[model samples]
Target: MKPLTPRLHGFVDYTACGLMLAAPRLLRLSPQARRASYALAGSYLGVSLLTDYPPALRRMIPFPVHGRIELATFPALLLLASETQGRNRIYFLALAGMVAGAYALTDWKADPDA
Candidate 1:
C-alpha cells in the first residue's frame, strides 16, 4: 500500500498527542503509567509543533527527521506496553502500534527541507 502524505501524518500526530494526553485520566491508570502518558503526550505535542509540515504550529524541525523519530519510537512504545498491565494499557498499546505502523508507511521524504 502507498504511504500517507506528510499532511495526513501531521493530522495523525496532533490526534495522537491529544489521545496520549487524555489516556491516563480517562483510563484511570497507575501513578507511574499516568506520568509516562503525560510525558509522552507532551513530547508528541512538542515534536508536532516543531515538525516542518503544513500542520505544524512552529515548523522548526524537518519532516523527514520527524518521521524517522516516529519510526524509532514505536519499538520503545511497544516495549512499554508489553511491560504494563490493564485493559486500558492494552487498548492504548494496540492503537499506538497501529498508528506507528501507519506512520512508518508514510512518505516522509516527500517534503523538501526548504
Candidate 2:
C-alpha cells in the first residue's frame, strides 16, 4: 500500500517547496544553480498551491496530474545535477531522490467522496 495519504503528501509538497527556495542560500550554490533552484521552487510552489489536495490553495490540477508533473521533474533534476558541480550537484541529486521517494510512496488516487 502507498504510505502517503493526500494530506501527508500535501505536507511534503509544501516542505519540499520551502527547502528548494532556501537551498541556494543554505548550500551556497553556483549562480546558475541558484537561479535554477529559485525557478524550481517557484514552479513547485505553483503546482502545490493548485494541486487537488488538502493543502492546496485551489483544486485545478488533479492529484494524479500533480504526480505526473512530479515524475516529469526527476529527469529535469538529474539534468541539472549533471550540469553542475560540488554542492549544487549533490543538492540536485538529493532533491531528485527525495522527489522520487515521495512519488513512490504517495497515493495518487482521488477520493471517491470528494
Candidate 3:
C-alpha cells in the first residue's frame, strides 16, 4: 500500500507549492526560469486548493483525478527540465522528482477525508 494518505498528500502539495514559489529567488535563476517557477507555483497552488482533500479550499477535483493529473504532467515536467540549463534545469528536475516521489507514495485509492 502507498504510504501517504490524501490528507498527508495535501500537506505535501502545499509545502511543494511554497518551495516552488520561493525557488527562483532562493536559487538565483535567470529571468525566464524565474517566471516559469512562479507560474508552476501558481498552478500547483491552484491544483492543491481545488483538490478534494482535507486541505483544499474546494472539492472540485477528486483525489484519484489529482493523481491522474500528476501522472499526465510528469512527462511535460521532464520536457521542461530538459529544455532548461544550469540552476533552472536543476530546479525543474528537482520539482519533477518531488512530484514523482509524492505520486508514488500517495495512497490515491483511499477515500479523501480529513
Candidate 4:
C-alpha cells in the first residue's frame, strides 16, 4: 500500500522545498553547497507549482508522474550531496534516502479512484 497519499505527498513536497531552501544557511554550507541547495529548492518548488495537485498552480503534470520524477532525480541529488562534509553530508544522505524510500513505497501507479 502507498504510505503517502497525494495530500500527504503535497505536504511533504512543500516541506522539503522549504528545507532545501533553508539548509544552506541553517547548516552554514559552502558556496557550492549553497548553490546546490538553492537549485534543488527551486526545482522542487517549480515542480510542485506545476504539479497536478490540490496545492499546485498550473497543474500541468500529474502527481504520480511528479513522484516518479522525484524517484529518478534523488540519486543525482545524492551524488551532488556527496560533495558535502561531516554532518551536512550525513544530513543529505539521510534526506535523500528518506525521500527515495518514501517515493519507492508509494504506489504512484495506483488508481486515484481506488
Candidate 5:
C-alpha cells in the first residue's frame, strides 16, 4: 500500500490500519500509543464479527460504529488529543485501526476456518 496523504482519508486509514495490526511491535510507540493501538485492534476484531450477523443489522452496525467512534472523528480527535503526544502518529494509528478492521472482515469472510 502506498503512503497516502492526509486528504486521502479512507486509503490512508486502510494502509496505516494494516501496518498497525500486522506490525504492532515494530513501531516506536509510546504507552498511550500502545493503548490506541489496542483500541484500534479491537475495532478490527469487531468488524470481523459483524460479518456473521444478519446482513441488515450488520449493515447498520459494527463497521459504521467503528467509523463513528474511531475513524470518523479521528483526525480532529488527534488534534484535540495533543495531551497524548505524538498527535500525528496517533491519527495514523487510528486510521490503521480502521484498516485492520477492514482487513479482519475480509479475512473472516475468506477463511475456511471462519
Candidate 6:
C-alpha cells in the first residue's frame, strides 16, 4: 500500500483522539475533522503495530519479538514528528522516522530479478 503523508497522518491521529474523547454521545465533527480522525486511527494503528507489543503473553513466547517493537517504532516516531512541529523533537523524530521508513522499505523491497 502507498504510504500516508506525515501531515495527514498527524491530522488523522489528532482528530481521532478528539473524537474518542467525545464518544458515546452524538457529536458533530467537521468534514476535515472526520478525515483527519480516520487517518489518525490508521496511522496510530500502523505505528502501534510497529512499536508496541501484541500482548504480554508474547513476552513468554519464543523468537526475538523485540525486533518487531523496533520496527514498529518507526511509524510511532513519524506520528510523534507530525505532532511535534515547530519543536526540536519534531526535527529529530521526523528525520528518524523518514530515514528508518525509507531504509525498511528499501531493504524489504528487493528487485524481482534478485
How many clashing residue pairs, candidate 2?
0
lDDT of 5: 0.46
lDDT, candidates in the order shown: 0.76, 0.88, 0.87, 0.77, 0.46, 0.39
Cα lDDT over the full model 4: 0.77
Ranking by lDDT: 2, 3, 4, 1, 5, 6
Tens digits of per-residue lDDT for model 4, 27-110: 887777778778878888899888776677788888788987888777876887677787667767876886887786666765
Work out how many backbone clashes candidate 3 has. 0
TM-score of each: 0.83, 0.94, 0.94, 0.85, 0.41, 0.28
* lDDT tens digits, residue span 1-114, model 2: 787888899889899989988878988888889899889889989998998887889888888899999889999999999998889999999999999999999878847124
lDDT score at residue 72, model 4, on the 0-100 scale: 76
Where in model 5 is the C-alpha error above 4 Å?
1-18, 51-81, 86-114
Which window of 10 residues has the lowest lDDT sum in candidate 2? 105-114
- In model 4, what is the error at residue 26, expressed in angstroms? 1.2
Writing each residue's lDDT as its tens digit, candidate 6 over 18-62 gives 543343123344444334445544544445334222322222322
**Tens-digit per-residue lDDT, 1-114, candidate 1:** 446787888888888888777877787878777777778778878988889888888888888788777777677677777878886568558657866777767886785332
Following a full C-alpha superposition, what root-mean-square deviation does model 4 have from the true structure? 2.0
lDDT of 6 at 24: 15
| Winner of 4 and 5 under lDDT | 4
- Cα lDDT tens digits for candidate 5, 14-66: 45556656554566666666566666665645553342233222433443343
Ten contiguous residues with the weakest lDDT in model 4: 105-114
Range of the 10 consecutive residues with the lowest summed lDDT in candidate 6: 55-64
Candidate number of the best lDDT: 2
